[model samples]
Target: MTGVVSRAKGAPVELVEIVVPDPGPGEVVVDVAACGVCHTDLHYREGGINDEFPFLLGHEAAGTVAAVGEGVSTHAVGDRVVLNWRAVCGRCRACRRGEPQYCFATHNASRPMTLADGTPLSPALGIGAFAAKTLVAAGQATIIDTDALGGWWDPAVAGLLGCGVMAGLGAAVNTAPVRRGDTVAVIGCGGVGCAAIAGAVLAGARRVVAVDVDAGKLAWAQRLGASHTVDSSRLDEDGVVAAVQALTDGVGADVVIDAVGRPETWRQAFYARDLAGTVVLVGVPTPEMQLSVPLLDVFGRGGALKSSWYGDCLPERDFPALLELHTRGRLPLDAFVTERIALEEVEAAFATMARGDVLRSVVVLDGSGAGATS
Candidate 1:
């Protein structure tokens, strides 16, 4: 099968032939219908996540099970599913404690997909769904009942729940747990940030503020349910904080989420929340980034300062419920799809994402044109 491969750091990804072996024990092979181009994929290409070269890219995806390995009774061939990196091991400590979302032991295929030349390829986030077909642990496939939705469901849209979208929505709905009548502010209006805004609205936040340096992103955020916008392009850190506070009636938001993941934006989120309010950081930051906040302030803040890992989501529980909401027309999850491109155009999609011209450039594999915006 053909797959996108980043053979070296700072090198453009190439569409090359890959060898996807049949599923081993406790694994499955998925015929990918659609996959989303995420920043994490770019990070892998840039060696930001790690120096695991020859990385097989693309993770956010949905597809049909083409084959299942031995002992994989949880899913069967032809099952419609979304791919997730966090496949919880039911025997993990966190799972035993009833918090599988925090499962420290996740499952991935025991074998690696390799290059045509026999070099092992590390699948991004243990998924590597950029190919026409990919292998994953059976636990990584979360079945979605499309027939129950009562209509044609777009895999291009449903696949997004696998990663970025799930993280954003879960960040607000689960991590911060936005409450009714609460005011929320989300920094960075990218795909994940916009999803957080939608989650805040779903959680009944009285007002949702979207902060970004880009006008297009802010507009997208508005469409996703942000009641107010803070254009931080011309503002200083204090200005950004003041803007959020002004929109929240001179106090501050009850929940402030930093989706940019930079130390500066994190600091803004730190100071932009009302005293004793929650601040959730969902953005992925580089290892070199550091924060030096006053110890006194940390004590006086009196609220939670937490980092969300994949929105603290349990795939079996959250993916289907959110997909159902999307089917009901209550969640504008489809809006996140700015365009649908072919698998070969993934490198170009990365450029589009970097230009900030699109919220999500999804790669459609089924040739169905289910949710093509471009």
Candidate 2:
């Protein structure tokens, strides 16, 4: 099957033939329908994630189970499912403590997807779905009951819950655990930040403030549910804080989320919330990014300073519930899909995402192409 492969760091990804081995024990093969072009995939292509060359990119995906390996009972052929990277191992210490979301040992397919020439390829975040079909551990496949959802589900939109969308939503719904009638502020109104805004609304936050330097992204945030927006492009750190406070009636938000993951935005999130309010950092940062904040501020501010990994989500628990919300016309998951293109357009999609022209550029394989979408 043909899949997108980043053969070298900082090089353009190529559509090349790949070898998908038969599913090993406890593994499953999914016929991918749609996969989102995520920032993480670009990070891998640029060697920001690691020096793992020849990565099978694309993880945010939804598909139908094509086959199941021996001893796999949880998933069966033809099961409509969303693929998740974190396939929690039941024996992990976190799982034993009833915190499977933090499972120390996540499961991936034991066998590797390789190049046609027989070189093993490291899949981005494990369940690479840029191709027509990909292999994964059975646990990574979370079955979605579209039948129960009144058959109102779209693979293009549903696949988003597999990663970035889930992370942002989970950051507010789970990490900050936004309370009803609480004021919430999210710094960064990109895909993840906008999802955080949507999550805040879903959690019943009284006021949801969207902060971003990009006017287009701020517009996107308002559509998703941000009650107010702060144009941080022309503002300094203090100016941004004051804008948020003014919207909250001179009192800072109860919960502030730093979705930009930069040192500056993080600092803004710290000071933009009420003194005793919670701050959640859901954005990812590089290793060289160091933080410097006043020690007195930490002592004075008396709420949780937390970082959310994948929105602290348990796919098995969160995916289905969020999908149900979408089916019920509550969560506007479809708003996230700006456009859908064929697999060959994956490379161009990255460029579009970089320019902030779209929230998500999805690769829709309609069972046509070198590798079938089914």
Candidate 3:
């Protein structure tokens, strides 16, 4: 199969022929239909994550089950599925306690996907969906309703569930749990942030404030259900907090989500909420960045400052529910899709997404129709 490989740090990924192993025990091979380009892929290209060379990029993906290995009964050939990175082991301590998302013994493919020349390829987050096919544990293959008119979920929408939407929606509905008539604020109007805004609206938040430096994103944020928008242009911590407070009777929001993940935005999320309100950090920050709030503030805050990882999602529970919501038209998952391109166009899609002009650019396979699943 042909896959995107980043042979070296700071180098462009090459579409190289790779040898995908047939599913081993407990694994399955998926014929990928579409994959969405995410910021994490770019981070791998820039060597920000690690020095794992010859990395296979692309994770957020939907595909069809092409084959299953011995002992696998959870899925079969022709079943449509979404691939997830976290495949937890039932024996892990976290899993034993019913917290599989934090499972210490997550499972992955025991065998490696390699270059045709015989070198092993490191798949990004164990997903590496930017390819013709990929191998994953049966558990990683979450079966979803992909029959919205293609081999996979309509590429135009099902593909986003591979990552960003899961992260954003989970952050809001699962982590923050915005209640009816609650005032919510989401910092960073990017894909995840906008999704959070939409989640807030769907969760019954009465006032949803979208914050970002980009005017274009803020405009789209409005469409996604942000009741109000704040352009974080010359605004510091106090300025942003004051603005949010003003929108909510000077008590700030009931829930503040820092989707940007920088220290500054995190601090803003910390202070932009009313006392006892929740703060959810869904952003990805560099390892070197240190959080430096006063210890007294932590006690005074009186509520949780939680970190939402993949929106604390169990794909088995979330993906099917989200697909159902999409099929019902209650969740506008399609609004996150901005463009549709072929596998060869993945590089250009990254550029467009980086500018924040596009929410998500899906790589639609030939048979799949655009945007219908959403």
Query: Highest lDDT among the candidates is held by which one?
Result: 1
**Model 3: worst 10 consecutive residues (lDDT sum):** 146-155
> After superposing candidate 2, which stretches have Cα over 4 Å from the reference?
367-374
Model 2: lDDT to the true structure = 0.92
Which stretches of model 3 miss by more than 4 angstroms? 145-152, 369-374
Per-residue lDDT value at 68 in model 3: 97
Candidate 1 residue-wise lDDT at 192 = 94
Better of 1 and 2 by lDDT: 1
lDDT for residue 154 in candidate 1, whole number 0-100: 82
lDDT (Cα, tens digit) per residue for candidate 3, span 339-362:
777878877887888777798887
Candidate 2 lDDT, tens digit per residue, 243-282? 9989986989999999999999998999889979999999
Instruction: Look at candidate 1 and give me any clashing residue pairs.
Output: none
Give per-residue lDDT, candidate 3, residue 142.
90
Q: What does candidate 1 score on TM?
A: 0.98
Give each model's whole-structure lDDT.
0.93, 0.92, 0.86
lDDT for residue 361 in candidate 3, whole number 0-100: 84
Better of 1 and 2 by TM-score: 1
